[model samples]
Target: MAESIRTGRRKPAGPLAYAALVAASLFAVGPLLWALSTSFKSPDAVLTDTSWIPSAPTLENYTIVLFESQVPRYLFNSVVVAGATVLATLVLATLGAYATARFRFRGRGASLFFILMTSMIPGIAILVPLYFLAVEVGVYDSYLGLIVVYTAWQVPTVLWMLRGFFQTIPTSLEEAGRIDGASDLRVMVQLVLPLAKPGLAAAAVIAFVYVWNDYLIAATMVSSDDKRLVSVGLYNYLSQYGIEWGQLTAAVLVTIVPMVVLFVLMEKRLVAGLSAGATKG
Candidate 1:
């Protein structure tokens, strides 16, 4: 009776709210279901089939994309680029965030403001300068150029997440480490990192997804076929004459699966990180 009264005190979600939620869900999921449906159909059936269920579903599209195309190589390239970006961002952001969280120095506010500003800057504003710099540095069409750009772009996310997490942590832990003769770097790597797992995981996964799915920078910076990231490589199915809808949909589904799996695996930590990062010290 007490629980019922407490529940009753809360405002009831009206029918309009539920309707809007259902509509939004369909808006997001309808395309995904259609893509999944299209991926299973043969080229002829793809056009003819209005129904979601295929008359004869097959793995032929996936098979062709995986075995007969450069898609696997593109996947590997994406992995390398994303991995490199994550590593680079982690290294830079850890030092920057730790310093920002732990120290009070000249221009500290300005520095943080600058970091936030950079994150807000539009990609288009920097694209031309980055492209020219890449060409001049001979990293155009090279993984190094994209890795560098992605690293710079993603560092602010980690900084925001890690700095907030670091602030929430008890400074006594670092003091204890120092008393035991551990250096700042040692305390960070051995002690602090273990506790900041949620933030780190959140940051790394966000970086991975951003780098993996990014098209503008990757497509603009690199023009070579073999060096193409998965997002750019998906365009291989398109021609001036027609679109390979089956292959395109199959590729899209395949590209989405890994990120979904990664998110599911780290969902708890991601939620924790986002919540903690939302609040300032």
Candidate 2:
């Protein structure tokens, strides 16, 4: 009886589990640490030790990348595109998610399935057609084009995430709001959305990160130097003769800093979003 009770009560924190966690964490963070170290190190240090710690840490690479290259402008462009994508995606995704979760409309499942199907389409396969559409519409090589593409591409997943969240919101809350003389739109604005704030935040952060890190669309859609987003603009640091590893690493880190900070801020919201469905159920 004692042995059975002990076995029943025991938790599963074994050496192998800890080792696996450590290995996964290292695998995920290794590139980031290497990049940060390389960014601070002079080219000579990279060639010599290649250690995480730089013998002579410096900000020269950051200064050059920020000031000398058109990186600052590209950063601005990326921020604009990402911001637009987030806002547009939130607006569309929230409405769609709410409708899908709450309404008993015709073809709703079909619409949702169609949305998810788009994700399976290889982006490169449709590039030529999308490029033509952009050119024909006179939005080629523009921030507007990138924003539209990112918003359209990401809205489906955002909708799925938010639909789950909205579904988890008690129907009674909206009913109570209605009993208190609230319309559907008002109920959504005042009650349902406020309740799903964490999920919305999670969706926004995901959209922001997606748009910010997208290189393929940014490279293809916006060809002008002035409109080039950060991901594409970073390619300027690479040359055939040799790569400016120091500057490139610095630029990469700089590009990632904003998203990292945002993710840290939204970590709680992300966790809440994950648990929302279970709690409601």
Candidate lDDT (C-alpha), each: 0.87, 0.86
Identify the candidate with maximal lDDT: 1
Per-candidate TM equals 0.88, 0.88
Candidate 2 has a TM-score of 0.88
Per-residue lDDT of model 1, residues 1-281, tens digit only: 74577577899889999999999999989999999999999999998997999889989999988888777888889999999999999889988999999889999899999999899899999999999999999999999999999999998878877899888888898999999999989998898888877778878888998998788999899998999999888875555217878888888888778778887888877876666564765
Residue 23 CA displacement from its true place in model 2, Å: 2.6
Error of 2 at 143 (Å): 1.0
Q: lDDT, candidate 1, residue 101?
A: 91
Compose the digit string of candidate 2's lDDT tens values, residues 113-148: 999999888889988889999999999988898889
